[model samples]
Structure formats: C-alpha cells, structure tokens
Target: MSFRMIAQERPGNPWFSWDYVQGNSDTILAALREHAALTAQAVLIATVVAIPLAVLAYWVRPLTGPILALSGALYTIPSLALFAFIAPYLGTGTSTVLVGLVVYALLLIIRNTLAGLNQVPPEVRDAARGMGYGRLAQLLRIELPLALPGILTGVRLATVSTVALTTVGVLVGHGGLGQLILGGFRNNFFRAEIMTGTLLCVLLALVLDLLLAGAERLLTPWSRRRAEAG
Candidate 1:
C-alpha cells in the first residue's frame, strides 16, 4: 500500500527502491552520463547559434531591437511552460530542448557581444579604418578580440541558465539532472531526490563557470594585462 512496502519487494535494489532512483551503481552512472551529454549538447548548440546572432547584432545596430526582443520573449517564458508549449509541435525530444536552449542563450550572448564591441574605443575603429583594414577585417581582428571578456561573461550567465533550464527538459521525457529531481518529486521523497538533483546541478554550473573563467584568461591575455595596469 505504501512506498516502503513497494520498496521492500525489491530489497537492496536501489534502482527499483522506493525512496530514490536506487542509486544502484549502473543507474547512477547512467543518469550522470546522460545529464552530462544532454547539457553539453544543449550548451554547444546554443553557443553556436548565439555567437553568430550576437555578432550580427553587433555589426548591424538596427537589428538589435528585433534580435533582443525575440530573445527576451524566449527568456520571459517559464522553463516548464516553454517546454510544454514546444513539445507538441516539436514532439518532445532533444530537438525541442535544443531550440529552447538556443532561444534563451541569445539574449545574454547578444547583449554581452554588443557591450564588448562598444567597449572597444571609437579611436580603435577609426584607426583600423584609417589603415587598410576593411569593415570585416576590423570586426574580425579588433572587435571580437576586444569584446572577448564581455562575451565570456555572457557565456558564463548563459551556461548557468542552460544548466538550470535543462532540468525542466525532463517534463518532456528528456533525461538530465531534471530527471532526478522529477523522479524525486513524483515519488515524494523530497529530500533525497531534490537534494541530489539540486546539488549536482549547482556543482555542474560552478564547474562550468570555473572552466570558462580559465578559458577567458587563456583567450584574452590582454584582459589580464589591462587589469594589472588598472
């Protein structure tokens, strides 16, 4: 009648156990691996799309309003609601999640990209033009380099958001850390399930932030010099 009774039936089998996902070695490893893959895929796709759109928005100021508005709308939708809304049309799989992640990533990426470009002094652009550099050349060589720090900051935010939102993908039957939380919620073992999922998610995000920070340092060595100078 109760979960304990159900759990007793499968004694020592944590996977089939009543309280948790049985944390049996295989099940736990599988969940961890699945979550990592999904999160990586979603983040990778979002970065690809966001970087181009962000760069485009930076180059063409007029597009900023529309580009930002679209991303803003995506950000406004609650994660679960967004997944549910798209699941019908997209049919509940990784594709739907990818679309959602990209939409959410655009706002942060665009803003940061534009901000970073803006931070590049007007004189620099003028000097580049004063030289033989073409518009595309200046953008590729100068603008992107100068904007790296801000872009990385945007990436940091986007990464955190992606990790959080990916959890909701579970509602669509997609597995991630969200699956863990959802399973826990469904079973009503609030602490074990919720705690495990939440902690893992937090840890994942923090690790990503650290990695990105290290990457920013590696990619933007000039930024470190600038910091030292100031």
Candidate 2:
C-alpha cells in the first residue's frame, strides 16, 4: 500500500485532541446535556419519593425496618442487572434508566433523611412542644430545617453516584456521554473519545457536588456559623 493509504487506514487516536473536541463539540455537548438532565430528574424524583417515605418510617417505627431493607436491597442490585431486569418491562429507553437511577438513589437519601430527623434533639422537640407547636408544624418548621444538611449530604452522594451510573444507560440507548465511551471502544479504541467521556463524567460529578455543598452552606448558614465558633 502507498504511504498515504497506510496513514489513512490507521488514523491516529491521540489520548487528548482539541481538534477532535472542536470537531465533535455538538455531539459532546448534547450528550452532556442529556447526562445532566437525566441525573437531575432521577435525583429530584428520588428526593420527592424518599422524603415522604422517610417521614412515614420515622413516625411508624415498625415500618422502618422493612422500608430501609427494601431500599438497601434495591441499592445492592448490580446496576447493569437492574437495568436489564427493568428493560424487559420498561422497554429500554430513558424511562428504564430513570427508574433504575431512582431506585439506586433511594437508599442513601432515605437513610440520611431518617438519620437527620432522628438527630433532632429530644430537648428541641420538647421546646417546640412547649411553644404549642403541633406535630405537623414541628416537623415542617423545625425538624425538616434541622435535617436539611443531612438530607443535602445524601443528595450530594446520590447525585455523584447517579452521574456515574447514568453511563450504564448506554445499554438502553440513553447513556449520554456513555455513548462516546462505548463508541470509542468500538471504533478501535479511540483514546480521545474515551478520555472525553470519562473526563466529562468526573467533571460533572465534581461540579454537582460542589454546587450541592454551596447550597447546603446557604440553606444551613447556622451550621457554618457554628463551625466557625467551634
């Protein structure tokens, strides 16, 4: 084969390439947007579902064991296996991945929520009661606010976890950046493509975690003040 043919046949697959990034900017951005959207949706739904369940488990002590067990069990399931199991019923799309992500998130959020609620000092509850705060009022105004930090911690963890797990959604054609990673492997181990996807996933997780941390600081300014005082 001529030199030109040989070069064309075995194109370079550099580990990092700004040229490749510029060429595929649209595709990369689209995948990133989808990844962010899926992670946010999954975490939001999980939080909504988890808070109520945590409250219910908190009040009805007997139900706590079962609820925690079920969520923990769901978390224990392998991500790929869980996706495969759901795909048969959900038909392999964003829905399947969303459901799986929500399932995976429940354990952390629920556990943290319950922990936060339980951490509310008995004296604090008594003080609220002394102020004529009804059960519902105390829970909403005092307990939930006090628990916000812990709940946000759980959310932060779940968000990071979901970002990584979202890549698994590629099995269902909704893997977002995962598509690039898989494509890289399939297309003769294109390092740039693989690195782009991998690095983006890591960056997304870091950015989300930092944002949540900032939110926690904003929402629980007292905690920051207390830390400074201590």
Candidate 3:
C-alpha cells in the first residue's frame, strides 16, 4: 500500500479537512485506543521478561553473553518474518502480534536493565551487605532503587518503539492505528483517517515516553536531590 496522505489532492480536498476528521472521529479514537492497548501489553510483557533476565545475567556472568546474544538475535529478525514464523504455531490474532512485539522489545529492555543494575556502586552494595542485607534484600532495596534511571530509560524506548511497531499488527488481523493507514492507502480515500491515525501514533509514543520519564524521576528522586545539593 502507498501509505501516502493527500496523494491526489483534489481541488476541494485539503489535508485534515475538518469534515472528514470529524466524521471519522469514532474510528480514529478506536484505532488510537487499540494501538495504545496493544503497545502497553507488549511492553509490559517484555518488561516482565527482561528485568528478571537482566538480574540473572548480572548474577551469573556466564549467562550474560548468551542472554544478550539471544535477545539480540530475536531483535535482529525482521518483524514480518518473525510474525510469519511464529504465526503458524501460535495461530492468528492479537496474541501473535503481542509475542512478536515483546520479542522486538527484549534487547532494549534487557540491555538497559543490565546496565542499570551493574551501575550500582559496589560501595553501596557493600554497605548494604555490612548492614546484614542478604543478596535478595540488598538487590531489591539498594541496587534496583539506584538502577531505576537506566532501567526506565530502556522502558521508555521499548514503550515508544512498541507503539510504532504495533501498526504492523493490522496485517495479522489485530486492530491498531496502522489499519487506518493501510485503509487510507488501499482505497485512496480516508486520507484524513490516515493523517489522524499517524499523528495519534506519534502522540501516543510521545505521551508514553513522557510518562516513563516522569516515573523515572519519581522513582529516582534521590539522584535529583543529590545533584541539586552537589
């Protein structure tokens, strides 16, 4: 599909003519919502997998190479090809799309998590250990808290990327804003829908990125306060 906006540009037609935009309000909203939902689901799933794997990789140095290699390998696969390979066994629908997106997300999230955890100062960990904190306790209370900044950086990337990629879900019969893009292209109509959907996708990614940044600030307030004092 062409995925072009206002390709014909009729004499009466204009980009984002109010009438077309208003008429397609429902569809635009629905697609926007579905796109958000799928992206969130995929990112959430990836986070669950990535965070723990990162910890494992850090704890077991031997696993680091293989874990990163695996995530990198999965991420290297073309989205459509990965979908084609998995869809047969997983069957069609949103589940397959979710899986593909999660796979796509793995590398960023995993690498970031590992980076964050490793960046925790050894002195801080030693202090925790001296204070009688066990491995798990020190990790949860000290390491992870300090690592929030970098880990959330990965989350911001994953969330934004997932939003962009979710458009591909339309091909597998999963509804997302991408469908409107394709719809507009295939029929050479609904240019407004395409424009609206495309903008909304960008808006969604921006919104999610901002939200995650806010979360990082809240979660790592100590760093901000420390920097201010310094």
TM-score of each: 0.85, 0.95, 0.93
Model 1 stretches astray by more than 4 angstroms: 1-23, 188-190
lDDT by candidate, in order shown: 0.77, 0.93, 0.86
Candidate 2, residues 193-219, lDDT tens digits: the string is: 999999999999999999999999889
Q: How does candidate 1 fare on TM-score?
A: 0.85
Residue pairs in clash, model 1:
14-22, 15-22
Which residue runs of candidate 2 sit more than 4 Å off their true CA positions?
A: 1-11
lDDT of 1 at 160: 84
- lDDT by residue for model 1 (1-230), tens: 78766555644434333455454446555666667677677667776777778878877889978988888887898877777788899997878777777677767877887788889999999999999899889988988888889888988888888888777778777757787778866874544665677777889889988999999999999878999999
Whichever of 1 and 2 has more TM-score, that candidate is 2
Ranking by TM-score: 2, 3, 1
Q: How many Å off is the CA of 149 in candidate 2?
A: 0.9
lDDT, model 1, position 14: 45
Better of 1 and 2 by lDDT: 2
